[model samples]
Target chain A: MPAPKKFSRDQLASAALELADEKGLDALSMRALAARLGTGPMTLYNYVDGRDELESLVIEAVVRHAAYPPRPAADWREEVRTLAESYWTTIRRHPQVVPLIVARRTTDEPTLEFGERMLEALARSGRSGRELLVAFRLVVGFIIGFAQGEAGAQAFSPAGGTADEVIQRGRTLPAERYPRVVEIATASARGDRAEEFRAGLDLLVAGLSAGARPASA
Target chain B: MPAPKKFSRDQLASAALELADEKGLDALSMRALAARLGTGPMTLYNYVDGRDELESLVIEAVVRHAAYPPRPAADWREEVRTLAESYWTTIRRHPQVVPLIVARRTTDEPTLEFGERMLEALARSGRSGRELLVAFRLVVGFIIGFAQGEAGAQAFSPAGGTADEVIQRGRTLPAERYPRVVEIATASARGDRAEEFRAGLDLLVAGLSAGARPASA
Candidate 1:
């Protein structure tokens, strides 16, 4: 008879990530992962120590997919934008993983590597060590924050509410009470979400560029 | 015998907020709130429609606490700082409410009023209507995002883990591999948490101020 298939830690983590993406994070369990892998739950423990270790492995795998190209020998702006877009794409592709990425405190090797590359890129652009670190965090925090809001919107979406439904609900409020919000909401409703993200990113990059100064030039 | 205490919608919501503050949002329930008020769970329905309504009401109450002062007839920078600080203080006081605030599609009246004042302040500072709205949201989004990170850290701080613990955890990686992260993290640990928040806020404000242009000549 043919030998039975073997499950490696990498394969197990990949399968777990797929399960999280297809179903939600809450639905993920060792039993289910084992079932998917054609192995008993106890056998799966041979690959991963426990759920926490499995989750950490999954996070590391997911983050590795999000890595940027080594910073271009160019302006910090391009480097920051590349890093932001890479990270954003990763979160967008695996919406379920985003929350886990945000919550996990481990300075795991992959994440530290990502941080080091970003810091070097910022430093090469003439930013001080402190400004470089802070700006790197600003971009990371902004993307994660924005992704959280976007993911929540995609998940809930008012249970079938349309853009008009949202705007109509806002308009029900007294115009005198929320004139500006009403006005902005009306305008924003007509606006594209991608455009808004880009605009905010532009402002952030511009603001950071304007603020950047050499610590000891 | 003395009359039983009367319960109002505001009172119920206030009690819920208090419960959330003491325990957490997850622990809040109709039964517990009713018990806190010395009334039956059915009694709460008279004030709030359901769990959803109670949550909405609690958000409104917390937001009311986050209200800013009337738009000061002063420079736009001071006005924006005041608004931002009001927001920061409000979210800090009720960190649990932030996710709800971010998720809700329709903001309460007071929040809208606060937005109008902010828009006016930005307009006075010379931002176009779109710029004003985007910039305001960027600031609000960043503050909410920062607060979430801080709250998450507080919630999951390694038991018996000091700043040194965080540093020691990172030290497992070879210095040659993650020198910059190790350096920045080591330096970051030297500052107090409060100082870190202030420094981040300063970076954001400085970035925004660099982008500001007066609306009126």
Candidate 2:
């Protein structure tokens, strides 16, 4: 075999991410990543301490790409919208990364920085610390949850069915049997995923904003 | 061998639900379900159509248990909260069923009925059909998504490292490296899941209620 190649932590993480993207996260292993980097497994360890560290790095890299624009000093509404969209885009791009994103609890630098910026923006809107924290969790949790559902739809697309096909199936159901589902599914079929995300995000932000408003002086 | 007994579809679905409770949804299969009911796989066909049909039945059964109290004639807020909590309790009882719940389109009869009641409540509150439909979806989607996260915590309870263990690790992170995460994680450690769910649900319901109010007479 040719002399083993040198791999940096970044290189190992990037390779691991690519593997996860291609074959899903469960398929990723230290040996597979090392081989992808053209290094021995032991040599790969010189960079990442273990699977947890490798995972942490991959998540950090993913979040780095999903980072929100610098927090606006005013207009928390726009900031929240931008931040949510950034996260949705990232999850959509790396659909497989989402389960990993949710499963791990990270103390990574970039994710923490992102959290701080979001908290600061919410604080600037004049909410109490507890409210700001709860709002922050709601926004992030909603985006993550919505993205997971969207990803599930993408992953579980039936062999012969599109969203339209499924909606059409609902429409043909006996009216007496499913009047409301048929009605809602018909309307929801025409509902674009992007539009749905925006609508939900707006609803959430509006609630938080209203809650933050000061009582009569 | 004892003569194979005839099995009804309800028996098969009941057995499958039991299997789900015992080993999770992933462990369920036609053979295991048939074995549990003391019948051959072929006999199962007499009651349910296939795996997909059986899954539909299991979901319907679980959802039936989630039914809300009949909608009071015009109180939309109470109606919505009751509906949300009912589904929440269903998910809590059958955590393994969530992926199936989220993936399948609403096709069961009881699920359809539940949708009708929710729509009627929203319609009475004066929102357009489109707004009511969107709000219904947002609520269901949020609950399903939140349950997935909560269920994951239960399913993957940190072996040797509970949330408490993880929080302790958070404390060790340099304040400069992870100020907000450390702060947030510290606070979250003291948080209760039921309280968190109630807060989120209330926020969502309050927001939708505000949006649905008629603008001027």
Candidate 3:
């Protein structure tokens, strides 16, 4: 009975992103998004065809807003690291969208644009052909994978403490059976997600630096 | 009605895994698993507590049977590679379970046992404390993350071909806008997934080797 809301495509996506962020990805449906927008499911169709379109909209909104540096750094490594950190910070804020982003392949303008910048940074390292593709994928994989790894660690931290806490409780396990686990857990009771993420990123960057030579020194 | 079918714990897990393998993870439910087993939902309760147990069972079954080398390789890098490949091959077979395994946290005996071996291999590199933990997590993350990336590529490959097909399609984009993407797509139309996977793994191993030093060496 009320007047229908006139929402732009970005507005629709922003609302959908908000829903997924607050309630988790599963809760983002046509009806739910419409209700959030103060509209009806039928009205929702005026924008998106269905779940696929809704998902794409949310994905684009997330990737588009990533705070890429104003320009690429002179050093390819720094460029890759800066761009990667930008992506990590963006996706980390919306944990619910992590799995969705990982699983759903999108050719949306925002994602493609991000990829172009990323590949451009890697190419600066003198990587060509498959090596370049592999490096690019490696960086992308690490960003998403590390996030998933952190999530898994949190899930395993039954007491809702740091991952080391999981290892701490795990210390009760017979040491003979899990010597390395106990040792690491005892030594690593302190945990920092960001530090750990950076450490892994450093390993990849260091490896890329060592393995692939620049076209000319 | 026919009498209820008798199944062991492993049998129950196997059937659930099969259901997930055939019908995707969403198809894995108490009722669906029960139906797969020629039983009723109530009967499934006798085996698994519910969805969580069912998921745990599937993950364990997949991880338990990984073809880990009989003894740790002489070189720590080789040891890590062997274990990671074992995990990669095992999980790659059951593509549906990749996300489930990545997302779910578990301390079941088999999963713990696998972790113990992995950490042991990593510890051999003299990466103690948090460094060891990060390295272990990096390998785990790479395995899962790389698989997710491959799946993403496949999903985006709308023509039902290799990931290059997706790139081929994108070649139509204005060259100036997607110069790097188009260049990579043009030079690298030949896709080899395993080769690409190994290439990424090589980067990680190379990174691990360069970053960590043995206490003795």
Candidate 1: the clashing residue pairs are: B125-B213, B125-B214, B125-B215, B126-B214, B126-B215
How many residue pairs clash in each candidate at the backbone level? 5, 0, 0
Model no. 3, DockQ:
0.53
Alpha-carbon DockQ of candidate 2: 0.29
Give the best candidate by DockQ.
Answer: 3
Off by over 4 Å in 1: A1-62, A95-110, A125-133, A154-174, A215-217, B1-6, B29-58, B95-106, B128-130, B154-174, B192-198, B209-217
Q: Cα RMSD (Å) per model?
A: 5.1, 5.4, 3.8
Sort candidate 3 into its docking category.
Answer: medium
What would the per-residue lDDT of candidate 1 be over residues A155-209, giving only the tens digit for each residue? 2222324445555555555678667666665666566656666776777777566
Model 1, span B79-149: residue lDDT tens: 77778677767867786665555544335556676777877776666675466656666666666566554
lDDT of 2 at A22: 92
Q: Each prediction's Cα lDDT score? A: 0.66, 0.67, 0.76
lDDT of 2 by residue, B1-217 (tens): 9666576666667788889988977688888887887778777887777777778778777887876665354467777777777777886788677656655555566776777777766666676545656676677666766665455422221231444566566556677765655565566567776777777777776777667677412
Docking class of 1: acceptable
TM-score computed on alpha carbons, candidate 1: 0.75
Tell me which of candidates 1 and 2 scores higher on TM-score. 1
Model 3 chain B worst lDDT window (10 residues): B153-162
Error of 3 at A212 (Å): 1.5
Tens digit of lDDT per residue, candidate 2, span A1-217?
9666565677777888899989877688888887887767887677767777787778777887876665463577787788778778876787677656654445466666666777766665675434555666677667766665455422222232434565666677777865665676677667787887888778887777667766411
Cα misplacement distance, residue B127 of candidate 1 (Å): 3.4
User: Lowest summed-lDDT stretch of 10 residues in model 3 chain A?
Assistant: A153-162
